[model samples]
Target chain A: MTIHYPKGMHHTSQVTNMMRTGKTTKKALTFSRRGMGLEEEINVANDFYLANRLAVIHKKPTPITIVNVDYPARSAAKITEAYFKQASTTDYNGVYQGHYIDFDAKETKNKTSFPLKNFHQHQIDHLANVLSQGGLGFVIIKFTSLNENYVYPASHLIYEWQLHKGKQSISYETIVTHSYRIPESLTPSLDYLVALDEWLAHINK
Target chain B: MTIHYPKGMHHTSQVTNMMRTGKTTKKALTFSRRGMGLEEEINVANDFYLANRLAVIHKKPTPITIVNVDYPARSAAKITEAYFKQASTTDYNGVYQGHYIDFDAKETKNKTSFPLKNFHQHQIDHLANVLSQGGLGFVIIKFTSLNENYVYPASHLIYEWQLHKGKQSISYETIVTHSYRIPESLTPSLDYLVALDEWLAHINK
Candidate 1:
């Protein structure tokens, strides 16, 4: 007997089409148009990067506090009750080319500005911690409506986070000027590492 | 309404007691005697490490594929159906003093050899990948029966993994000779970083 799994829960074949066309396929475009998040796309890209031995980044699993578990006969243990816990760190983190890369991917429908509310205090703290230890920390912000993505450094985000305490948002102009724009690609989809290299070079200079 | 969560699911008070006594408490001793896992102890250590700004390691949450969710009025979404997914990497990973540290904590009741079957192939591969990228990868193997823990480096494990193709386990002698014995402590419990430093120095020599 075969068990049918739910869609979007597993790796999707959209990666193959994206690899071939260097863009989202008609099906994927439709799915995204219907409000599917950028997370799936980034997961696929991370998979691509891992397969090619380019990077070893992974999305940290959602922390859940298991309340009750059931053991059915001759079957796997099932979590009958669980509660989602707030993550203390970012969504993605791993080693890339001997550098520790830590970041989260966020998408904004607002084309004018990216709300600081999209980031949490703990995440900012985690990123700052990574930076203090000589690691690379940044966020990949996708202006979904505008069809653009930017690699905003943690330092810049922290600055804006403190500067706009009352305002609570960073204008698009500030992001575009302060952040490095990630170039779109076929296999990796969001090649944010390119932007990371540029940002590292700029900071070092 | 108050929710009485299960014990050991959240951060336990064992850490505070351990901090004061520099050893496991009576309750923790009783729990361990009753076959409770080492995951809780390690988690407390990780917490202590993070709080002191010494390291930023964390256990990757168990991946679960959610099939159904229900959003009740003004409450968090409840996952009605979900299944555990196989993790692609090791359990614990983070930046430590500008070095990327990745490892998994495993316990075995066997008094002699540690069964090779205790580790998954994917985890071995992931560790090898981390090693290739100049990161530190090791396994903290606890011999529960003997009340001892050892930090086994990834390179040694990979070597043994290939050497013991026909054999199913690494002899106790082999592990003791090849691995660094982690000195147990109060504040951090298992101070494996000390073993890591020795291993690094050995490799550099």
Candidate 2:
């Protein structure tokens, strides 16, 4: 398994790509007692792996340019003024068994196709850069209405998002043809890493 | 080997603990580089890990509760109004081996001791929760002036942090006595996992 981060920094990507990250999709979920976003689901899965002594992976903090901090007490510093910084990479990345894993996650309710608009050019370029440097790059897609997910290689998404710009979107069939489908289950709800297993079997070699 | 997260997704304590997390006292540094911040260095190291296929770890996205989003175009949504949601756990975590590894990175300019104010009570509680669930937890400490790094198990840090509200702060000697000192080097400047290797050695036995 390999994940790529190019030029030693965060890779900037699509705008929608930034907002609806992992479980952060904004269609206004009904607030399930168990309802979590794709990002949160991934976090819970990562926790499942961690609690079982399986892996280490976490979310990045918002890169805050904290301009004003007040140390009112000897021990406490309160951040008073801050600005958000643009990230240069996908939403999630990490290392496992000498393999680097990099990915962005998106969720859509359309249930027909995944819009290429969900990804950005920098993300595509970053993926290529990672692949060039010998790493694994992918995206996890979820059609929440259908409760289905797929692991699409960044290479494939980049090619389509670039050369096929006006194509508007990539259909479910295209995803099935080009990506690895993930299974939904307990503890690790969306087991996309298992899709990586397929990638390893077929692509990484 | 353990880290604790507090209830209700409140992350103030953990964030505080991470900022001033140092267990040992060393000579004060004469200079400081802008890149010495824990998040940036880990980003670089994570890139290295990804490029080299060593591990896959990512910082989760900043949790936000969006009150409003503007649909500029068909595909993009701009977050016009949003508040940072308290993270339930630390910003960094991931998977290595079949074992789960999770941690936060902290840095301090002080020479002799790391302030406890860098961490939050909630963060400590969270690490303990993570450990109770059977996760490998720790913190990466960087002494900028000394140009040295150390990986202290969360179990160790939590133990001391809890005991120290009485003492005002943990002693440098106590930190050095309880933590794993990290030596700086090439490949990964603060390769704190070497300390984790020692921790795992004891745990696996």
Candidate 3:
């Protein structure tokens, strides 16, 4: 293996780069293991953007309400016990190509139809708010059973969710009718932002 | 208590409004005990805008680099081990009032100064990049010791950090010169957006 830098050439960026990541050898023993979480993959993709100075995007920390904390030291506040809280809005949002982007990710095991139950009312409400305020909003739907992924606009998700009483799930045919498929790649693997390009082209005109 | 319908109400919105969060009093106590995280509070504020058809804003999820995960079921994939991959940009970024908003929140225990150690070079670069793009960017600093808060613009943070090699912390006096104090009682308590408002007023002219 070739080393990238000399021993004495340590810099601040190099230190932060080290703090940012670690090299994992691809051991032949691992694939009962799944890859990154949906959020984490997106973060790596965003880093690809940051490395090239393309567009700026990021993910907020998992919001844990720290009910109890042990101040073991002066600087470190260890959260001893905490619980997860329902997120009020979409999980991903940022600026790209002079446009605002907001989205959420949901995965399903079903092969043919995606259940509307995976989405919550707050998410729907959040999407409506972003759209009303004139920002682009959408969802990344992953059909893990088929390894298929698509970007469906939040407008569409809310529309389908509103019909939950009458219809519990949206058929794959319907998703195909309205959603855009994301191509698999190294960076921005979900690559749903391509759908955003189409949305922008159609709307900006 | 009596169950009363506020007119004809069967919709989900009505349901959410009807119950005391749809849990037993004991369960409700546990649920209510869970406080929203900083990101969630910001999300709640964004939801208010969404619900009222105001500006669009959202918190992105933290990007993580997944080294290992256990898929016990087809429906649920649990990430057993993961390290935070370095993010290329700031924590929070979104659109508001047709303008781009970007920021990071850092808390410190010191009442007299905010240590430069809390921020990194990458965050500074991200903020600088946004400003270069003609976007609004800032930092939200909370003095947990004094229970006081301020929104210091990114330009100032970068400026001070450049001086960090010479002086390790940004004195409170220096911060006060270049930052905006955010008071409590706003619907979105951080209300750093107000600082952005003043920033826009100053810079756009």
Best by lDDT: 1
1 versus 2: better TM-score goes to: 1
Candidate 2 per-residue lDDT, tens place, B117-182, comes to 878876786677566545667788777776656777788888878788623666567667767765
Candidates' C-alpha lDDT: 0.75, 0.62, 0.63
The CA-based lDDT of model 1 is what? Answer: 0.75
Top model number, TM-score: 1
iRMSD for every model: 1.4, 7.8, 4.7
Residue-wise C-alpha lDDT for candidate 3, range B1-205, written one tens digit per residue: 1222223221223224325334454354334424644556566666665444446655555555444445666544444444445666676666776667788878787999988878778788878877665567888887766655677888888887787653489898888789876544235444455555556667769
TM-score of each: 0.81, 0.51, 0.61
Docking tier of model 3: it is incorrect
User: Please, what are the lDDT tens digits per residue for candidate 2 over residues A1-205?
Assistant: 2333223222222233335344533232223314688898887767765554444445555554445545666654454545466666676655444455667889899878888778777677666656554456788888888877788888888777867773589888888798877744433655565666667778546
Off by over 4 Å in 2: A1-86, A92-103, A108-117, A121-140, A144-171, A174-205, B1-87, B94-101, B107-117, B129-136, B143-147, B161-169, B186-205
Best by DockQ: 1
- Error at B189, model 1, angstroms: 1.4
Looking at candidate 3 chain B, the ten consecutive residues that score lowest on lDDT are B1-10
The TM-score measured for candidate 1 stands at 0.81
Position A164, candidate 1: lDDT: 79
- Of 2 and 3, which scores higher on DockQ? 3
Residue B177 of model 1: what lDDT?
94
lDDT string for model 3 (A88-172, tens) is 7777777665556678888888999998878778778877767665567888887877766787887888788877752489899
